[model samples]
Target: MSSRRRLLTASSCLIVLLAVGGTVVAQMEAGDRGILPIDSTGTLEIDGIHVDVGGKDAASARYAGWRIAQREGFKKLWAKQHGRPESEAPNLSDSVLDGLVSSIVVDRENIGPTRYIADLGILFDRARAGELLGMSGEVRRSAPMLLVPVMISGGTATTVEIKNPWQRAWAQFRTSQSPVDYVRISGMGVDPLLVNAAQTGRPGRGWWRNIIDLYGAADILVAEVSVQRLYPGGPAYARFVGRHGPDGEILGGFDLKAKDSADIPRMMAEGVQRMDELFTRALAAGELVRDPTLITVEPPPPVEDELAAIQPVAQVPLSGIQIQILTRDDAGLNNAVAQLRTIPGMEGVGVRGGDKGWSILFVNFRGNNVTLASAIRARGWTVSDVNGTLRVVPALQIPGAPSGQ
Candidate 1:
C-alpha cells in the first residue's frame, strides 16, 4: 500500500450507514445458541449433564427432569462461583435458559418406566445468559455513556418518550451492572431538543458535543433503530445502528428478528447488551480509552483495575454495505478509510469482494443513506445515492465530473 497523497480537494459523497435487517450475527447458526465462544467467566453454563431417573418412560422421565436438572445445574454453578449454596441462586426461567443453550450432548442412555438417564452437555452463550442470572462480571465508572435512542417507524423518526420505544427501553435498562456508565435524557423538564436521527451523518463533531453535555455524559452512543413489519400486528424486522454520538462514526450495526412489535423492545434490549460487550472489549483492549481532544472535560486518568480484564467479547459481527470510490489505488482507498475513521463512530473499512477503478469498500458504519450523504456534503464531497447505493468522488476534477445526483 502506497502512502501517496492525492490532490483530491474533498469528496462530496456522504457516508452511508446500512440498516441491516434479519439475523445480525454473521454466519450465526439458527436459533439462540451461538456456535462461537463468547465468554469464560462469572456465569457458569451447565454443560455435560448426566442425570438418571425412572418414570413412566425413560425418555419422558428424563425429559421431564431436564427442567428441574437445568435449574439445579445453574444453581450449582452459581454456588461454586459465589461460594453460596445452590439454594441461594436466584430462580431462573425455562424460556430464558432454553435460549442460551447451544448444543446438547447425550449418550449412554438407560431407560425405565417413566424414567430415563443419560449424559447431556448443555452449552450456553454465557455472554447473554449471564445477564438473565444477574451475574455481570464487573462494572467501571470511568465513562457515562449518553444514550440517544432514536426509533424510526412509519418512515418517521422520533426520540421523545411518547413516540420512541427504543429510547424508552434504554431509559429503563438497568445500567448499574454493565461497565459502561450510561446517561440518558428523558426529554423531561426544560430540555432543548437538539439531536434527531438525521444529524448522525454530519462529518464534524461540533453538534455532538452539545448533545453530550446536555445529559452531562462523558461520551454518547446513538442507538438508531428502524422497525418494519410486513403486516400490521405481525412479525417485525428491526435494523439497529450503534454509532458514536460525537462524530456519527459507526461502532457497529445489526438486525433483529422479532415475533412482533412487542418483541422489538426485547430484541433491542439484547442488541444493547451486545453493544455493551463490544464497548467493554474495546476498553479492555485499551482501544476506546478517552481522547482528550474529544471533550472539554477530560476523562479521569486510566485506572488500572480488574474490571477491564473480565469483560469478555465474541467476534464482533459487522453489518455492512459498500460504496464505490472512483480512485481505487492503494493510497486513495487507504486514505479514504483513514478520513472516514476521523468522523468518529466508524467501525471499520475494508475491500470486501472486488475493486474496480471504483474501490468497492464495505463500510461497516451506522446511519442511513441520508445521514451519510449529508455527512459527505458537509465534508464537501460529491455524493450520488441511487436507491441506497452510494458512489463518491473528489470534487476537484473528473472526466465526467462525478455523475449522478
Candidate 2:
C-alpha cells in the first residue's frame, strides 16, 4: 500500500470515530428533557372515573360521556367525603355542576363511531365544592416532603434519571386531597444527576440536608416500585414500598398486578394512591416525621460593629411617641425602621401606615421625644419636630462613600 493511501485511511477512521462520539453525546443530552409534572394544586380531584355513552356521532358521544362523568365523579367524591353511598349523594343540576367542576382529565379514551368509552379524572373547584359538601375551604397539609420515586425494572434501579411510568404516576397524582405535602420535581436538566436511585440508599444526613435545602422540603420520601414480568407483553406484578427520611425506613408495602403492558399505567396510578394512603396513615401515627438528624441549624452570626449595636442608656419608662419616616423607597424606609429599633430605650416600634414615599411609625420608648431625637441623630439620621410628631430622615447615601458612617 502507498503512504498516501495509508494516511487517507487513517483520516477516514478518525472522522468516523468523531461522528460516532458526537452522536453518542447528543443522545445522552436528550435524556434531560424528561416529562414535566402537571400541577393540579388546590383543586379537589376524583380519578378512575369510567364513562361510556353513545350518541349520533363521536363528538356528541364524548360530550355525553363527560356530562355523565361529572355526575358520577360528584357522587364518588360525596360518598368518599361523607362516608355515605353513591346512591345517597345529592342530585344537582347540570348548570350547578358546571359551576363547580374545574376540568376533566381523559386518562384513556376509546372513540367509536357513535360510542365513547373512557377512564377520566375530574377536578372540582375546592372553594365551590366545599359549599355544597359542608367542608372547609382550608386544607391542612404536611411540611414539604421531597418525593424520590425509584423504579426497578429489568434488574436496574432508576429514578428521575430517565422518564418512566412510576415517576409519571407520582407527577400526575393530585396532592390537594392528600394531607402529605409532596414536593415533586421534574426529571429534567440536573435533576437526574442529583436524585437518582443510588441517592435513596445513602445513609448520610448531611447529603440529605443539602437535598432538602435545595428543594425547599423538610424531609424526603422514597417511593420504590419493583416490577416483575411473567412474560413479554403479558401479565406483570409490581411491589411498592413507601420509605421515609435519610435512613429510608420502610413505612408500608403493597403488591399490584397488571393484566398486560397497556395496563401498567393504570396499575402505577393505583399504586400512587395506595402509597399516599400508607403515607397518610403513617403521618397520622407520627411515623412520617422528619428525621431530627437531618436538621442543621446554623447559629446566627454575631454583630460586633459599634454602629450596629445600641449604646446602653437609662430608661425613662414612658408611652410611645409618634414619628413620620421620610424615605424614597421601601428599602430606605426599612433601613430607617431597623436603625430606630436599635435605640437603647426603644420598647417597641410599629408602622401605622404609608406608601413607598413615607411611613408613619409609633415608637414606644422608655424616654421622652427629646431623648429619642438625640438617639436618632446619633444613628446617622436627621430629626426635626413637626408639631408634636417627630420627623426622621435617613442618612444621605453619597456616591463612592460608606452609608450611615
Candidate 3:
C-alpha cells in the first residue's frame, strides 16, 4: 500500500476507535444506580409476633414499642461511645417515648386457621406519614384504614401512709383510689380545717409547720386547695391540708386560684402536644432511635438534556443554511454554545449579543446533508430547508423565531 494511503487508513481507524470509546464512556456515565420509584401506595408488613400483649395484637397494645426500641438502641450506643454507664441513659418512660413511633402501621395476614403474620411499615417522618394518609382526595379515596400502633406506659408507683388517727378514719370512709390517680393521705390527728388550710395555703407556712410538727410519725403529706377569688384581698381561698408522717413532709400539694382552674386544662393539653412534637423532632434528628427498615427513598436520577447530546459533525452540507438558537438568556445561550462546540465541522458557535435571546451555530458542512439531518431529527430537533439552506433548531429552543434572525 502507498504510504499516503496507509496514513489515511490509520487516521480513519483512530477516529473510529475514538468515537466508539467515547460512546461507551458516555453510556457508563449516564448509568443510574438509585432506588427504583415504587408506587407510594404499597403494602407494609410488620412482624406481628413482636407485639403480643395479654392476648391482644401487640400493635394495638404496645403502640410505640418500635420507636422506644429505636430510642433505647440510640441511648445504648451513645452510652457505649461516651464511656457512660448504660444505666445512666436518659430515663424516658414508655409513655414519654410513645409519640416517636405512632406512625408505625401493622397488618395481619392469615397463613392458617391458627396462624398469622403481621406486616409493618413505619413512616420515617411526619411528611411521609402525611403522604401515607393521602395528600389529596384522590389518594385518600384509594387508601383507608391505616392501622397504627399505640404506646401505653405503666407509671412508677409511690407509696404513702396516713399517720394521724382521725385522718385514717376519714381515709377508711372514702372510696377506693383509682390506678395512676393520687391517693389522699389520711389519719393524722390534725384538724380537717387546719389540714384544708395547709392544703389550700390559708393558714400558710405557720399552719403547715405546726401540722408537720404534729405529724412527726407520718411519712408523706397531701394537701388540696381551692381558690375563691383573684385580685387583692378577696374572700377566695383554699383551706385543705393533710400532713403525712411524724416529720410532716409534704408529699403532694394542689394549688387552686380561680384563674388557674380555667387555664390549667388548656395548659396541660399544650404540654402534651409539645412533648409529642419533641419526640417527633428527636426521631427525625436520629437522636432518639434508628430503624433500618425506615429507609429514605433515594431521589430520582436527573433527566438528560436530549438536545445537548446532539453532536456536531463535519462533512454535512450547510449551503445557504442559517441556524439560530433562541435561549432564555446569555447563560442558556452559553450552555447551548458549549454543546454545539462538540459537533464536528460546526464552528463559530457563539452567544448572541445584547438582551435579544439566542445562540448562533455556524456550521461548515462537508458531510452528507441527508445523514446530518437524520441525526438531528433523531435527537428531537427540527431541520428546515430555508432559502436553499438547511437550518437546524433544537426542539427545546423558543418557537416562532424567523429564519436567519
Candidate 4:
C-alpha cells in the first residue's frame, strides 16, 4: 500500500479504537449506582448489607441494570422531550456515577467498585437493605408522584372539630413528610353523619358521595369520632383512631380514648404521634415507599458576615479631665482631642505622639465619681480610674499603647 494510504488507515483504526474504548468505559461507569425504578409490585430484600430486588424471581441482573438505566435516562429524556430548558437537564453525570456504584454492588458476576456483593436472586428484604442504606424502605421506591393515603378515625369531637386536628397529627407521620397529593378526612362532622346516614339508607346517600367526592380520597385518614360523648360523669369519653392507605386499602390503624375535652387535644396529639411512629415502622416493615421528590435538596442561601452591619464606636467621659492623645497620625490625634474638648465638663484635651498608629488620652475626674467611670465603659471604651485620674482608651487599641499604662 502507498505510505499515504497506510498512514490514513492507521489513523482511522486509532480513531475507531478510541471511540470503542470510550463507549465501553462510559457503559461501565454508568453501571451500579442509581435510583432504580422499582416495580410497584416488587418487594425489596436485604441479604446482609446489600439490597436485592424481590417480588419476581425472574428479574435478571441485566434486566435490573436496564431498568435503572431506563429510569435514569428517562428522567433526562423526559425533560428534553418536553422542551425543557437545557439548564433544567444539565448533565446528571453524578447520578449516573452513583448508579454505577450501586450496580457493582448488586451485580453477582462482576462486583466492581462497590464495597460488597449481594445475592439478589432470591427473596430480598427491603427493610433489611433500607437499614443498611440508612434509608427508610419507602425511600427505595422510585415513584415521586404516588401518594399513600392514611385514614384517621376516632370520636366525633376529636375528629369532627373544624380545626382538623388530625391534619396536624398526620403531619407528624414520617411518611407524611413525603409529598401528599391528597388528604381525605372521614368522620369529621357532617361527613360521618352523612356516611352513617347513607349506610342506614337515610336521605343523604347522594350528599355523602358528594362529600367524599369533594374531599377526594385520603392517602391517610385520621378519624376522631366520639365513640361515646362525655356526660357530666359516668365514664363519658371519645376515641382517636388513625389509618394509612393506598387506593383506599387500610395499611394500619391505631386507637386511643379521651375522657374529657382537655384530653381531646392530648389524645389527638398522641394519636398523631403514634401515627407518625407507625408510618415509620410501616416503611421499615416494607409496607410503604417514600416519594422521591421529598429527597430533593434545595440550594442554600449565600452566607453574610454577622458583624458587617455594625460600626464600632467608643465613648469616654470628660468630667474635669485633662486628656492627652498620642498617635503616629498627628492630625487624627488632634481631631480626637478636639472632639473631647466639646464635652459638658470644663476639662481640657491634648494629643501626644505614639508608636505605629496608636493614641493615648488622660482625664482628671475633678472628683472620684463612679458615674463617669461607668459612662466611659458603656461606650465600649476602656477606662482606668488610676488614683482618681481617669485614663480613656479605645477598646481595640494596639498592644503597646499607653492607654493601659
Best by TM-score: 2
lDDT of 3 by residue, 1-405 (tens): 101011111112242323564553332112221111112232211112232222245443343444443355434433543578767766555443333333343333223333334333332233322332232332211101110011111221111121221222222221111111122333223233334422432334444445443544211222222223454443333323233222333333333222343343222222222333333343344333222222234679898788876786454445323356556576776665666556555544433243345445555444555655665676676887555444666676656765555
Instruction: State which candidate, 1 or 3, has the greater TM-score.
Output: 1
Poorest 10 consecutive residues of model 1 by lDDT?
A: 1-10
lDDT of 1 by residue, 56-153 (tens): 76656966656656666677666755787878788878876666544343424555777776654444456766665565646445477776677888
Each candidate's lDDT (Cα)?
Answer: 0.60, 0.81, 0.35, 0.39
Judging by lDDT against the true structure, name the best candidate: 2
Better of 1 and 2 by lDDT: 2
Worst 10 residues of 2 by lDDT: 1-10
Q: Score candidate 2 by TM-score against the native.
A: 0.65
Off by over 4 Å in 1: 1-139, 202-207, 289-292, 297-405
TM-scores for candidates 1 onward, in order: 0.40, 0.65, 0.18, 0.24
Q: In model 1, how large is the Cα lDDT of residue 304? A: 71
Query: What tens-digit string does per-residue lDDT give for candidate 2 at 1-405?
Result: 101011111112242323564553332224553556666665788877888899999989988988898899998999988898999999999888888887777777888999999888777888789778767656678899999999999999998877888987887777878899898877776788788899998898888899889989999999999999999999999999999988889999999999999889889989999999999999999887778888888989997899768787675677789998776678877887888888887888898887646678898898888889999888877788877788777777433432121
- Candidate 4 wrongly placed segments (more than 4 Å): 1-161, 164-226, 230-248, 288-405
Ranking of models by lDDT: 2, 1, 4, 3
Off by over 4 Å in 3: 1-321, 344-356, 368-371, 397-405
Deviation in angstroms for 227 in model 4? 3.7
